[model samples]
Target chain A: MSVENSDLLKTPLYSLHESLGGKMVPFAGYLMPVQYPLGVMGEHNHTREKAGLFDVSHMGQVVISGENADQWLETLVPGNIIDLKQNRIRYTMFTDDNGGILDDLMITRRENDIFMVVNAGCKAEDIAHMRATMPDHLELTELNDRALVALQGPLAAEVLARFTSGADEMDFMSYGEVEICGAKCFISRCGYTGEDGHEISILAANAEEVCNALLGEPEVEAIGLGARDSLRLEAGLCLYGHDITTKTSPIEGALQWSIGKRRREQGGFPGADKILGQLASGDIARKRVGILPAGRAPAREGTEILDAGDNVIGVITSGGFGPTFGAPIAMGYVDLKYSAAETPIFLQVRKKKLEAKVANMPFVAQNYYRKPK
Target chain B: MTTYYSEDHEWINVESGVGTVGITDYAQNALGDIVFVEVPEVGDELAKGDEVAVVESVKAASEIYSPVTGEITAVNEDLEDNASLVNSSAGGDGWFFKISISDDSELEGLMDADGYKTFTAGLE
Candidate 1:
């Protein structure tokens, strides 16, 4: 995130955010709203119970084209991009040579090419990495003139179906280019929060009008990054710089499921040797596990995790109060020996050791809209 | 009862040398929704400027410092069940703890209502 203080950039919805009484703060070089008058807790619960709209224009959107784009993408990421069905999305990561993740992204196989969304903070670096490594036959076009908005929750499809036809019929991880309120947009039925939702990419010129139309629906409310973080945390989704970083491998981050089975056997992609070896032998020394604190005190990032005997075992990477759970929850890397679902761990919070247990994640069950076969 | 304010946004209402303490409305509004609060235990001795409590909002955690030299005599237990009291009524029902002033002279260094208002305005 660029906090240079020189001059924070504003999104297309800047005036709309201010009009809604959004508390703005600097994030990823853009002045973004961290919460509205509903506050973080209210917005968070509303997203779980009803629907919430988020302006995610800060994320990088790029289109990869030319012949064999999917094959070239497979070399950069461990995911099986070549086999991706048209209009389907895959969660994958760009890895460094040593198996560390450069950035995790969403890859959607469009009709004639692939569209990818990367973290805003790392977008510049990601683009540079692709330009330097990819062959001349591949084309990477940055969609800087577009805005991305996520409409999330159980009521999302119902609310969105009012404006666009065939939206409710789209299954999870599926996408299509459709016209929303007279503006053409690429809509994907996916989001960071573990809820059935859609992310709409529209031209920056039409962002404000499109978002206003969405908010006009009674079920939709404007949500800020504060609620977004807590929502993803409860869903056990990893935040880029915090939960998973260059120092940690995918196996250690517990993202093995993201690696395609064919790629695992073929031994392609960066850091394949280290990642595949660990996957085959199950020799990962540490794993990311969810920790449920016995008390209300939130064990924030950098809080030390200790054993019963007061020996330091790990450290909390992300921790906060889960409003839905009404308790303090955390996720951290713990030694594989103590990473089981029910294993008890201790957290050193403000000079006192508090007892916590390793719990299964999504601490809340995911509500993805999987189509019935 | 005279209410004195600290630079850190804590307000203490003093009566008969026993002071009731809590954060001000401005502090609560800035912190958004309050989730948890950790107050000093009864009978804990504290000096001025000591970190005596913690206020954890949804996004971040902040420390509440003691404004004057005092010993904690009683703590409001209602906050354990309803932490939103800090958000609803920051200076009244949200009072964190009551303390017996060890040295009443230290109160002179704190700001009165008008003075604190000017101090907070200058901060903006």
Candidate 2:
């Protein structure tokens, strides 16, 4: 696409990124900053050690308005929307008739509406699905003109708190509207890097101003899709296309917890019966687990996982050398028998068989902030 | 003294019977930041164009091929700890290995400095 056409779909801070020497790349149909002059590793380490500012504007933001929006949305998702308090967010999924995952999303309840953020690549399809099933009274408004920025790391809270008062008071998964740089915006204490951070929603017009304000801070550095992928992988978060797809179910992906206990028993949502049956009878043949490569060689996606006798069991979904761990890590699905922590496995990297072991999720410790009651 | 370039972008500076090898500046720039370098073991025999080492960037991993048939005499151990040196001095101190040439005539098949410059110009 032409630059203007791409910028037409640009998030709020496109110009700001270009001004800072960011190399733009087409991602999810929107032009996004992939890295800055300092490069990906610099940004990756900066986020792990301090804070990394990311313009995740490509993700679709939508507001589900009208009465009973929560009740109507609950019918389509497996989360318990009725029990979800105001300003609280929950990670959820939409299922197909066969219990396969259609999309994974985040749902937040407001006083009079429900807000959601879905994957950029799957936004159009997800909105269409929701609109078809939603009650007539509910209005689905896609906030295409809004920009989303994610400030992730241990110091994210401290850095963002400077702009938004009472930011520290907001606990994990809680969100509220606040004024940042004299512009009103929505701030949520949530992130994908297993760190204590915030995702800010602002008007596209004010995106550059707000980004510049954040970048002015010494602790905050611009991060791109390259480090974003690696950080999320190290955090054990699944990428939509690679880790979870239309054919994958929450149960097989180790995301059963996303389906609330009440919803599990009621079985009203799509593929409810199939998913619930797997939960109860444990019929899933394979499960997703973390893989730590024995050496420096990274076994990338599509690499085959082999057993002792070189029997192919599963394939890697995402694999790379984790900058923080200083070693190669991956996530893949293997037969239940070989999915246990510390189970020996081998990844076929080219003509070589690299040793690996099934390990626990979040190869690094998660740094989320939870408030004590 | 003479210099040669491999198709895979490695350059070798030969003096006496030994050759010092490293990736070219163009290769390092194209690869972006170097995070890890897997060096071949010293004393390993390699044929021309054999995959002897690996260089990993943040986005992808690539194999470094041998420029000429030779027995590896030494390797740059500093790269194992500070791989970024390749990005800073790709054609100088970042040299990967030194090999005792098995056949001096193999250099005839490689590109000279000017030829390499012309070759990389076409790539851009």
Candidate 3:
């Protein structure tokens, strides 16, 4: 279906994807490619073996600046924003008044401003909340016309380095501006796939040209949302809506590391008291884990997770067959008792019980490149 | 020969005393790329319109239903590892299984090739 006629919003790369035989679907209010001609499994394995280019332009990119940008942002999030050096990126979370998570985002301190990229689905609400809460002196500029592309996989460095010199010198979580294909853009040495990759944020006008330039390289192929999901899953990353929400706490979701020690002790940000209490006392239930059906069956989202006696413990958030693993794998929450790795669990698929296990995440190892200090 | 189609998009071709089953081309196209197939074991008895097997693609999974009452006499074991055969040839080499017809009289209820085409046309 054409993007203009469809109810879903269109990204700058929508036409490019259609020309390349991408099967479009509605995602986060945008018409995106769910899979290309290479298909989902092929794309999934390809990203693991080689570099995959993804048009993540739908994500919201905003720049916050002012004399008090750092201090103001620190009040809204739990990250150590004041300690972030120039050109450094930090993964952070937005919490509610009760310490419930609102969204997860990546914050980078540019030379003169703080740049943040948030989930596309939550952009509207995030922007509105920030505007209403922040002081008028703090300027929040939404880069709505910009497009972002992610080149992820083990071989991402080699291919990306050809375009931007000294890209290999930057370590994971570092970012810098570089000129590529005759356009200046911000490149961050980070990605959702848990691989040694980069995310390039460029002007929307240059999006198509940049994508085509990358695709012209022999090692790079356009990936779709299908591979994007599995890649993040294999990386053990959480999807915001599924793995995290306003109702879920960081401690309960196993994301204690994102909360700074000072924040936990000082008790600032939303719901800090409730979240800190959970950290000290512990959750009544834990967001545990589960594996795939040992057989050929693929356990999908919303499937019921059961214990030995057919009692419900948790629900599957993201479950599907992993092409690289050659078996089905999933992640979900369970009772604290059954949350341990290798614990046996049963997934009710239709009329039969499918055997599964509580496997550790990153189902595959992450290969991020970090420079030695 | 007569044919029947399931709502799940599988088709059954019945002859004098035997029946052959496979998924429809429309089903294969909607499924994107086929990666795995779970055919029923030989000698398994099936009721009309029973879920006899499963087909998995990169994006989703679907159940394949039997179109007639029969006992499975043969299954295409090759598809277990090479499920792409269904995407390439959904009707011919992609035939999922062969059944020893339990009721030859049931063939009268199925549609012919032309009738099946007309039935599917209504779907789109």
- Calculate each model's fnat, 2 decimals: 0.58, 0.29, 0.42
- The structural similarity of chain B in model 3 to the true chain B, as TM-score, is 0.88
lDDT for each residue of candidate 1 in B45-107, tens digit (9 for 90 to 100): 999999999999988999999998889999999998888999999989999999999899989
**Per-residue lDDT over A283-321 for candidate 3, one digit per residue giving the tens place of the 0 to 100 score:** 646764646566767777788889999999888888777
lDDT of 2 by residue, A1-373 (tens): 5556534466678788888888888888888888888787788888999999999989989999998887788778888888999999999987889888778888999888899999998999999999888888879999988999999998889988898867977889998999999888999899898888999999988888988899999999999988898899999999998898766788889998888888987878888888889899888988989999897777889999999799999999999878888888999999988988999999998778988999999988888998878
lDDT of 1 at A87: 97
DockQ of each: 0.76, 0.44, 0.50
Clashes of each: 0, 0, 5
Point out the worst 10-residue segment of candidate 3 chain B by lDDT.
B104-113
Stretches of candidate 1 off by over 4 Å are A1-6, B121-124
Candidate 2 chain A: worst-modelled 10 consecutive residues by lDDT: A1-10
Q: A355, model 2: CA deviation in Å? A: 1.3
Model 1 over residues A192-303: C-alpha lDDT tens digits? 9899899999999999999999999999999999999999999999999989998788999999999887998896788999989888888987889999999888899989
Residue A292 in candidate 2 has what lDDT?
94
Off by over 4 Å in 2: A1-9, B6-8, B16-20, B38-52, B65-85, B97-124
State how far residue A219 of model 1 sits from its true place (Å).
Answer: 0.6
Cα lDDT of model 2 by residue, B1-124, tens digit: 8889977899999999999999999999877778778888898999988998889887788998888899999999999778889999998879999999999989988999999999999986
Docking class of 2: acceptable
Extract clashing residue pairs from model 3.
A97-A271, A98-A271, A99-A270, A99-A271, A288-A333
